[model samples]
Target chain A: MLRTVLTAAIALAPMAASAAEVVSAVLRIERERPAPISRLELPAGDEGFMGALLATRDNETTGGFLGHTYVLHKAAALPEDATAALDDLIEQGARFIVTLAEADDLLALADHAAGRDVLLLNVSAPDDRLRGVDCRANVLHATPSRRMLADGLAQYLLWKRWDRWALVHGSHPRDREKAEALRAAARRFGARIVSELAFEDTGGARRSDTGHVLVQRQIPGLMQGLREHDVVVVADESQVFGVHMPYRGWTARPVAGDAGLRATAWHPAHEGFGATQLQRRFEALAGRRMTDLDYEAWVALRAVSEAVTRTDTADLATVLAHLLSDDFELAAFKGMPLSFRPWSRQLRQAVILGDGFTVVSISPQEEFLHQRTRLDTLGVDEAESACPL
Target chain B: MRGFLAGAVALLALGPVAAWAQVVFVTNEKGNSVTRIDVATLEVIDTVPVGQRPRGITISNDGRQLFVAASDDDTVQVFDPETMRLIHTLPSGPDPEQFVLHPSGNPLFIANEDDNLVTVVDVVTRRALAEIPVGIEPEGMGISPDGRVLVNTSETTNMAHFIDTETFKIFHNTLVDSRPRVAEFTRDGSLLFVSAEIGGTVSVIDPASGEIVHTIRFAVPGVTPEALQPVGVRVTADGSRVFVALGPANRVAVVDGRTFEVKNYLLVGQRVWQLAFTPDERYLFTTNGNSNDVSVIDVAAERVIKSIPVGDQPWGVVVSPN
Candidate 1:
């Protein structure tokens, strides 16, 4: 299944001598192993952290002209000095850093890497300030914004006529911001928030004894008889009480948001449309499985690889220039061709909708017409984004 | 002159009558049913109820008995060609999805999906003689013409496991891309064509060495790569053209047998899973499970000449005897 084109990039013609020299771009990713964001469980079969890096690298390096390679530095959150380690990685010839970390942590790292000409990519963060008024010039994002995920979920809800929603939010800045996005989507799609309830994550021992009974009482009590709304949207990103909201704990009405209906980056059933081959290849190389982090790594690598394949050399400037140009076509195993947003350098792609084991649909949806592609409808359009650089 | 006229008349009377060549049988998966139709008349002649989820089907070499692998029932339901009755049942391996008959008409080779094994059964006794372990989710089964090797394609591990029929040992494990569902060896035993449903391409691999030499990519807009997948494949009698049933693409893609290059698409019914040809190689038939219809294609014309209505959710289909 492994098909290598084996391009002879070193033996090119003499006309391109004045052009940018081929510099090997190394991207070092610092993150947790087997990280779970929303519903994408990593290091499983098909896709995982390192596997994703290679997929993107392989895709971008297809023509072999671009000399960008992603080197992943994965470690658990408890054991390592993430910031110093990233600095050490940069000293070791890596000029780009992609991190799957807390919003504050990533911002600190980005600020530390500032003035050094090193770009820091925040793969998964819901911090509004990143894309809002406080966006950075060198920092890029591969994960869909919280607003985008909410809108992606709400489009289908709007389509299904589940207009009346009882909003339940967890106690977190990110969770509240996500709720704001949901509220905005609700307003835009003609949905009504009948009531708002806050579920504070009071950390205690694993609530195995009285958890189910307590959840049953609190959830049903908050909703008050179940007919008040068509859907109960829970915004709990901390994994606190999200799983307990379905079936017996919550209102009999169908659950949306974090647990019941989730929007994610990848799933196991995405094998159709030649995804399986990429997944299989990655799995074969990496003994452990792939995750969403792997996918982010993959996209980053692919971006560079694509530039090399399309342009003259594996030069950093040419690769960057090609990526910034509109003619760039990157295939990142999402069953479609993808392009980046000009303003924020955010990659526009489809968000997968899931309910436990079954994959429901991909959002931005097939019908979200935006003239050329429906994938354009997934994230912030160029006109709406505030990032000037 | 009177004696010569009498001899010519005797010779004319001695010739055999032409056998029927326009019939196709479709097996319904959920309905546990088999529908027989006259290809020329475009009519359902009979519908016989069989066992659970009848998937793999093949006609006996003599064309008298139709063998259907009833997976849930753990047996191959044998039907009488003329009456369309449940004549008998052949004991198959655990969870059979596909089966192939020996060239000598003595044994039946079956690919058991759940067990990851291929069972060789004695045709006369309807008993499994040997069960050889292959790979994960072994679905498609086919035998080489010279009766030397039996091939099984596994879905999960993405490999085609070739078994030496005499020793019943897995001699070669050819790693394909991903989710390889079906396999068929060329008539001359030179090439083994395996279709990967997930890979969305048919790989032409060497059966002896388990090396892939050629891969054909199938693509069309408005259709997913999953749908453009090559599943059931059949080569022409002359070995010039290969017809691959593109699952859910609603077409049978024709490829040059020698070059392994796709020629054109032959539009068929929806979700076309399996194919069968008549004894004379004049007509080709395919079962479209989703549309619940059987398409009869004129082999020479390369088009769906007629559609025969069949039972619900037809999966495995084959041609019976004259």
Candidate 2:
């Protein structure tokens, strides 16, 4: 259906000879790599890259009326060194670049484009260091940081009066960082971390003929002697063993964090506050449910489009200025006007807490209040941010 | 003094004869019932159980039938107003949230929140006439006084889809604030007001051009912006006053229709969802969802006169025309 509409729109495009200025956006995505676990299904298509394309279409829908047109340039399968890719897009008159890269690569790209007249939007990484000590003036983060996601889940857990948590983590660097975020959230929300355990990632095939029996016995034994806790929090972004801990725990407790009732930027089951429309549009365009990375990429591109349309300027400096100003706010169907925090340049948004099939709740719960904005209560606030910019 | 004495004597002579007995119907979403209130006596006369999750309620053009959108049941239950009994059920689309009747009294436009379609059903035939494809999660429905144009607000899309009544085609889509829940037109049909629940503002749109002319924002002294969610909108018959229900703030903001400035905020019950006016426009009723009651506001006095307890989660309200 979306293809038919686009084809019809293209067929009718030449009839309107209005001289509309064109706004160009470039998306740079990393090449697909094999997952650590063979059991995990790979996404059928590029997640964040497809989201940028759909957002460009959405931008054109409104931009067409404002004497503006949008053009998207896709740079897929880019190598680790994004310098050449950035230079190529910059040479092609692309002022806005949406980067779907890891934290280190994103920082490198940001530094490479620092003195240039371009803005880079980070849409994939959720590293706290990027929003804190290594924050960049030219780079804005659309995805929520690890701390924000942890705080969002912790707020709900506290609201449910589940103050004691049993922390479990995998043997990975990213998992350790995520566990640290959970620890910080526990301290911030007055929750007690009663027990901490680590599961070693033994090198083996994730699935075997008799793996379920081993997992059923091993998971229960791993959690047998834990102290009494209200909830079991797992930090396993590597998808190692968290999936086995949900129904296999010995105490029959609810799981949270990276598994079970998880907090994410977007969920496919979210239909409240008009999110159903977005889900329908995404499915129509991408032929699948939108993932969290897709939503972040859409938000990044939409932020650029919003600034351009509001200011009526394609000038990079002017658009960036408008985006960073206090007056700029983007309505991305999160039930509130989403804006960026000036201190860290992190977009403030509501996080969804879901139980795989349906959305259980949204963060920034009624009890967690902030002086300036309630959304700021979810992540590192301006007062605590280490970024000098 | 002589004029005052004459007015006092006239009031005594008129008595209850001048007061009209109005019936206000409030739909309780969670309780699946409708509470009928007698305006003159200020009492809940009867509570009729209808269907599962009744949200939107309205009266027919002739005032003979009352329509309530039973969202969960996927039907719009029709009731005889005089007898307060279910007469028939119209096949509404899935998850019908709100609906509006055409001024010509033939077709009803219903917003299906889950299906992303607007189901147009014939009132008398009780059959669907047309189902128009709209933006996602269509919730609010408004028809022009002349019935030439119909507007549906999609909550997630944040766009007010202006549908041509004659063609049943979307002529224009105007983007409003976040989570637009209600759309209302002025008496003259020149201006349209869309309340965005999460955007915290009411956008005054120019219906013809599909452009937002002005935005009305509410700011109470102690109320936070997150809690000041604008949901239901009601414009007076004369188009002089516009009332907006602030969802969690528990207040109704009265806006000067012509000047586009907020005049006053009348306190109501918790989590007000929808509003309706009496036939004479003398009083306005608000369904407070959290408090599970209906608040009666004397329009002339601009104050809440009474709070009558009703069913659980009172969502939508409509008064009889006669």
C-alpha lDDT values of all predictions:
0.68, 0.84
lDDT of 1 by residue, B209-242 (tens): 7789999777666664435757898877677878
For DockQ, the strongest prediction is: 2
Query: What is candidate 1's CA lDDT for residue B284?
Result: 83
RMSD of 1: 11.3
Cα lDDT tens digits, model 2, A1-389, are 11222111111111122344544555554755436444445666678877887888777765654456788887754656578888888888777788878787888888888899888888888899999999998899999999999999999999999999999998988899999999999999999999999988876666678888888888988899899999999999988888788889989899999889999999999976557667777898899889997898889888887777666667778888888888677777676678989899999999999987899999989788889988988888888889988
Q: What is the lDDT of residue B231 in candidate 1?
A: 81
TM-score of chain A of 1: 0.81
Model 1 TM: 0.61
- In model 1, which runs have C-alpha deviations exceeding 4 angstroms? A1-166, A173-197, A202-230, A239-253, A259-389, B1-23, B45-47, B81-91, B171-174, B188-191, B205-213, B224-226, B306-309
- Residue-level lDDT of model 2, residues B1-322, one tens digit each, is 2432443465578894543246789999889999988777778877888999899999986678899999878889999875667899888877788999999887999998766678888888777777777765689999999999999997655678888887787768787877789999998999999998877999999998888999999999878787889999999989999999998899999999999999999999999989999878899999998899999999988999999999998999999877
**RMSD to true structure for each model, in Å:** 11.3, 7.1
DockQ of each: 0.03, 0.15
